[model samples]
Target: MVRYFDAELETMPWTDVLAWQAERTATFVRGLVDRSPFHTEKLAGVGVPTGVVRDLAFLEDLPFTTKAEVRESQSTRDPALPLGRHQAVPRGAIHQVLSSSGTTGQPVLYGLTATDVEMWADVIATAFWTAGVRPDDIAGHLVGLPGVAGGLPYADGFRRIGAGLAWIGGWPTERVVELMISLGVDAVLATSSFGTYLTDRCEDLVGIPAKDIGVRKMLGGGEPGLGQPEIRQKIVEGWGLDVLSEIMGLGDVLACLWAECEDGGGMHFCGQRAVAVELVDPATGEPRAWEEGVRGEAVYTTFAREATPALRYRSRDHVLVTATSCACGRTSPRIRCVGRTDDMLIYKGMNVFPSSLRDVVLQGFADDVQPSIRVWKDGSDQVRFDGPIPMDVEASDDLAPDRYREVAAAIAADVRARLQVRVAVTVVAPGSMPRTAYKTPLVHVRETDDDQ
Candidate 1:
C-alpha cells in the first residue's frame, strides 16, 4: 500500500502486483460498504456478500453499478448525514468542492479533502512520468473551469515535475496563438483535435511556425480522438514534436490517469492508485475477450480512490485492452479507447461508430474545416447517423445550394464503398452551430426551438 505511487508497479512482476491488489481488495471493499451509505445500499441490492471478496473471480460476485445508479444516488441521497455518528470525516474536514457538468440535468456535487487532492496530484504525476513527461518542459493549459476537473491536476502534474506552465484557460483560437508565441510554450494540455487544429492554423497567425512554436506534449480527455492512431500521428508530426502522449482521466474518478506511449497500443493506466481495468460485454455483463483487436466496455475499479471509490465502474467507452507486456517494457495494463457505447449505432444493419466514421472523414477534410455529427431517431429503437461533413467546405463552397446535396451524395458514396450503409450529410456554415466557450458540441442538427 505504501508503494502505491512507486514507478516500479509498471514493471512489477505480474505475481507481485496481483498479490498486492488481492491483499488490498478485501480491506478496501470493507471500507466502502461500512462507511458510504450509497455503496452499502448498492452492495446489498446487488447481492455483494457482507464478507470480504478475496479473489478476482469474486469480483463478478459483486453487482455492477451503472452510471444511472450513481446519478440516482446523487439525486436522492444526501451524502453529508453520515449515519449519525460513524462519519468518514466531520463536515468541516472537506477542503474543496467540485460540481458535475449539469448539461444533462442538475449538477452532482462532491467534497475533496486535502489528502485526496495530494493523492490525485501524486498519482497523475507518476502517470505523466510513465509517458516520458519531464520536469524540464514548459506547459500550456486549455482546461476550461475549476469545477470541470480538466486542467488543475494536469498542471499539478507538470508542477510536480518542476515544469513551468502558461495557464491559458480554454480561449479563442486567436488568443491561444498570441500566447503561444508570446510565452514560447513547449507542451500543451489540451484536446488532441484542438491541438491539431492549432498546429495546422498557428503558422499564419502566431508568426512562429506551428512546428517551431515549441509545443510538444499533449494531455487531454473528455473525447476519444486522442486514442485514434492516425489522428494522433498527424497531430504529433504536424507539430514536429516527438512525444504525443494521451492520458485517460475522469472528473468524478481521478485515479484512472493512464498515458499512451509511443507504441500506441493501449495506455498504461495509473496503478499508483488501485485501478483495476476490466474489459466486459456491456449487455451480458460477461467478461469480454481482452485480445489485441477485440473491443469491449472498460470497467475500471479503484481502491485508492478515497474521496469517491468506484467498483466495477463502467466508463461507457468501448476500448481494446491488452494485458500483454509492451515492447516498450512497461507492463501496466493498457487500453485503446475505440468509441463510446452510446455513440455507436446499428443503422440499416451496419454496425457504425461516430468515431469510426470521424477518423476517416477528419483525415479526408481540408485543414480549416470542422466536422459535425447528427443522429436521427428511427422507430424508437434505432438511431441513424448523418454528417461527417466539414462546415465550410460543404456550406460555403462555390456550389452554393448544391452544397448539401453534393455532401449527402459524397457521404452516401463513401458509405456505400466503405461502410455499406448510406447516411445523409448536411453541412452548416462555419460557426453556424454554436457551442459554449469551453466545450465542443460534436452532435448537432437542424432542430427548431419547438422541437425541444
Candidate 2:
C-alpha cells in the first residue's frame, strides 16, 4: 500500500511542522498586509502588530474570518477584482476559479493561481495516499464536475499518484455501472450517500451484488455519515469494500484537507504545509487544547496561497480531535467531524447535534430501520424546540407493521437515554423516506414561510 505521498514532510516531527508552518504564515501575512485590502482592513481594525507574524500564537489575536465576510467581500467586490477583496493578486494571476456547493445560502467563489493549483494537487494526493490509494488502481470518479472544488481539482490529485481515472459522473446509473465493469475500476471516489446508493444501483443494473462487481475500495466524503457506525457498516457490507475511508474538506479553505488513513481510526490532517488548523470552542470561540477526545470547531488559516488566502478562517466545522499520533507514522493530528455549528440545536439547556441523534437511532435500531432518517422542523430557522423534537425514520423492508410500536418506543427510549434529549419518533413505511445520490440532509424543514 502507498504510505506517505511525501515521506520526508508527511513523517516530519509535529514540532518541526509547526515551526515550518509558522515561518510560512509569517511571510504570507506580511504579503497579505501589503496586497489584500480585506486582510489589511480587518487586521487594522483589530490593531494587529505591524510586521510579520512570528509565531502561531499570534493567530489568536487576529480576527476570525467568517463565511459572511467572504460572501460580502464577493458581493461588494471591485469590478477589477472579481474573486473578492480577498483576491490578493490580479485577475490575470488566477488560473482557475472554484465554488462551494451553496447548499446553505449563496455560493462563495475562490480563486486559484497556477501555483495554487499545483499545490492543491499535492495536498489532495497526500490525502488519497493516506487513504491507501496506489498508483495502479483505477478509480471511478462519481462526483459531478462543475465549478465546484471537488471537480477537476480532485481528479487531478488522484491522477498525480499514477492512478487511472474514469470521469463517469453525471452519466446514467446503468452507464456508470457499465464503465465500472469495462474499465476494471477497483476503487470509487464519491460522496458517502452516493456511494451507498450506488451499491443498490449497481446490483439492480447488473443483477448481482455490488461486491461481485470487482470494486474493492471506496473513498467517501462530502458528508459525515460514513463515520457513523451504522452507516459505515452499510457501505462496507453493500460494497464489500476492503478499503473504506472518508475524506473531508472546506471549499473556502482547501479540498480534501483531512483524510482517513488505512489504519482506520480517523482522518489525519493532510494540508499541514498549506493550512494551519486550530481547535476552538464553538460556543465561546476560545482556543481549545489539541488533546485526544477534545471536541471543538476547526479553524483554518491558509498560507502559501497566492490568489486568495484566508487568515484565521472560521470554518465552523466542528470536529473531535481523535489522536495526536497515529500508527501510520504521520505526525499531524487526527480528527472526525461531528457536525457543524450551524447545524447544532439547543434543547432544554443542552446542545444537540442531529447527526448524533441519527447515530443513536441507527446504532440502536439498525435492524428495524432502513438507515434513512430526518429530524422534522416546524420552521426553517427553528433551533430551540420546547417539545420532543420530531423525527421521521423509515422502516426497513423486512420490518413488520406490528413491531413498529416496539421499535419506535425502543428508539425513543434509547435516544433519550443516550443523548439526554427527547425525540418523538414517527416510523414510516419502507421506501417512504427520500434517499439521495448526493449529500443527505439530516434535518427536514416541515414548514417554511413560503409554504405557509
Q: Which pairs of residues clash in candidate 2, taking residues 3 or more apart in a chain or in different chains?
A: none
Measured with C-alpha atoms, the lDDT of residue 92 in candidate 1 is 64
Name the regions of candidate 2 deviating beyond 4 angstroms.
45-55, 447-452
Worst 10 residues of 1 by lDDT: 387-396
Model 1 steric clash pairs = none
| Best-performing candidate as measured by TM-score | 2
Give me the overall lDDT of model 2.
0.85
Per-residue alpha-carbon lDDT of model 1 for 320-355, expressed as tens digits? 775556776666667777776656666555677767
User: What's the TM-score of every candidate structure?
Assistant: 0.81, 0.95
**lDDT accuracy of residue 416 in candidate 1:** 58
lDDT, residue 300, candidate 1: 68
Over 4 Å off in model 1, which ranges? 1-5, 45-54, 77-89, 103-105, 203-208, 348-351, 360-420, 426-439, 449-452
